[model samples]
Target: MSQEPDRLFAQPLAQVADFVFNEDVARVFPDMIKRSVPGYPTIVENISVLAARFAQPHTTLYDLGCSLGAVTQALRRHVRADGCRVIAVDNSAAMVERCSEYLHSQDSMFQELLPVEVIEADILALAFQPTSLVALNFTLQFIAIERRPELLARIRQALLPGGALILSEKLRFEDAIEDELLTALHLDFKRANGYSELEIAQKRSAIEKVMLPDSLQTHRQRLLDAGFSQVLPWFQCLNFASLIALP
Candidate 1:
């Protein structure tokens, strides 16, 4: 274990960013991300269903911001075995290192399965192949709003004409009543996940300073501006929404 501060849930923006990028997220991530909701199995199942949309035989799957390879693991099981590859990318150095190590150890067991590769690089700058299926799962929210369109365009350029892009996010509802209800329900979820009211309040404040998530309409428009032929919200749970975009 690293001697670093436990910034996963207690630090300010810059400190947490440094810790996330420099320290192994697999070591501290579960305590943070996994605690965002109750019923881990159900959340995993929902994620699995969303990921299955991109799985195909002999295809290259791009997992942008694949923290600790959780989604990658699910994708491997969802996709066909023959010649499939999962290119898991993250800007966090520590996350990349840990994911690479984990994949290497797990590779031999999955010899007949899809190949998983971990890359330490920015999602916006990496070169994506035209044959890849890109998945931005709970990741695009962290990207700056202004850069989303350009990033989407780049992703479209990297994907084949008919390739798919799956994006899941925490969405803001247009209806006031719906928004309030979801917000309360999501908060209840956090509480059920072992967070105290005080902890939840403090964490929300800290997260707002660091994470910049755009509205659902904005995200949809960006995908359209990027030249995707079809873009639609496919699934929703409270504030969470899964969007599918096809090139």
Candidate 2:
């Protein structure tokens, strides 16, 4: 409800640093993500709907890399399974602090909703409980490429039978022409959302070193390698895509 417009990259920068989720980013994340990620609203909203379908009674729902608690709130809003609790985790202290505040706001406005626990910790370091739903929305791409397989395997191991892990990411294409087209279209999407040329250039430079996307085929295969029986892609807007992997 209290989303500040992103102006972090509005000014000219002599050298853009790799992006980090700090207090400044926590303040403007809602605006930045919505404007930057195409169909982000649809993905988050439908994540909740899909979460409702996968949520099992008495199981915990995990929202990994839950910056500002967007997916966390969605899961709380739609999940009706009995005794279900939401655990939102982020490595950034600033993000977890604000996410807790936002979830508290949602709590005041709702009734009999699932309880939420906001944890400030790295997802890979923490021990997981059997979870019914795990939302990894745009979080995995920031992780080190070499460590992704173990991370997915960990998620798969933690998931209960009939549970799922919903992963949303900016995708990369192996095809040269397809990659070029989608990249241009994504830049246009940012332009349409009011990001200026300077802002776009600066932001892209900042995230390029940190955010590394994989191809859709790689994602599906990775999920299978992690022991998930199915990797169902439910949404794809421009270069962004969301997949539901079942264990």
Candidate 3:
């Protein structure tokens, strides 16, 4: 479904605070993400294809930090595993409320689709079931850096044999020159998407401290440390990339 255009950062703010998934963000999230993130639609759609491959019958699939149910709906649309159900979790009430509405719309429109349960809870606190598929799309960067390994280990422990995890995130390049060039290109992408110069600058200021990205090497090592047998990078657009991990 198409979303409204994002104009949240068009005007200059006297004081730009750290970004949060609040009510305003929930309203404009669809537009904000599409314009701000490169290759988002491709990532969201391919997640379902990956789900179809890895989803085991009667096992649960997870969409952690599911905003407005985009990935949840993708799973609902593509997964064919018998008795498989989706559990979508997020901490923001505003996002959950709107996401539930979207899912209800999806339910009425589709038939014989996998069922989904939306929970207004933190991902770190949930007691995970033995899962066949887990999608962590752009969610890990917001988590506390120190807590990331434990989170991945928990997911690994919860995963059934041959289970898969789809992890997508904005990456930080280790090389200073490459990082500078990519950052500029990403900003140019935002400009092309109708974000004003002030908007791009302000948004970056707001999120720089809150969203902490890791290098690809770091992510690979951590996944290995968490017991994943292999890490395969399936897609990369500018600074964003998605990886599939097998346990």
Between candidates 1 and 2, the lDDT winner: 2
Q: After superposition, how far is residue 30 of candidate 1 from its true place, in Å?
A: 2.7
TM-score for candidate 1, please give it: 0.83
Which ten contiguous residues of candidate 1 have the minimum total lDDT? Answer: 11-20
Cα RMSD (Å) per model?
A: 3.8, 0.7, 0.9
Please give, for residues 33-116, the per-residue lDDT of candidate 3 as tens digits. 999999999999999998899999999999999989999999998999899999999999999999999999999999987899
* Overall lDDT per candidate, in order of appearance: 0.72, 0.94, 0.94
**Candidate 2 C-alpha lDDT tens digits along 1-247:** 5568999999999999999999999889889999999999999999999998899999999999999999999898889999999999999999988888888888889898789999999998979999989999999999999889999999999999989999999999999999999999999999999999999999989999999999999999999998999999999999999999999
- Flag regions of model 3 displaced more than 4 Å: none
Which structure is stronger by TM-score: 1 or 2? 2
68: Cα error in model 1, Å? 0.2
Q: After superposition, which runs of candidate 1 have C-alpha atoms over 4 Å from their true positions?
A: 1-25, 37-58
Q: Residue 35 error for model 3, in Å? A: 0.4
lDDT of 3: 0.94
**Stretches of candidate 2 above 4 Å error?**
none
Error of model 3, residue 140, in angstroms: 0.2
**TM-score per candidate, chains pooled:** 0.83, 0.99, 0.98
Q: Candidate 2, residue 129: CA error in Å?
A: 0.2
Model 1, span 6-120: residue lDDT tens: 2455433433222234464466665566567334335445555655555555678888998777777777766653577889999988788877776766666674557777888
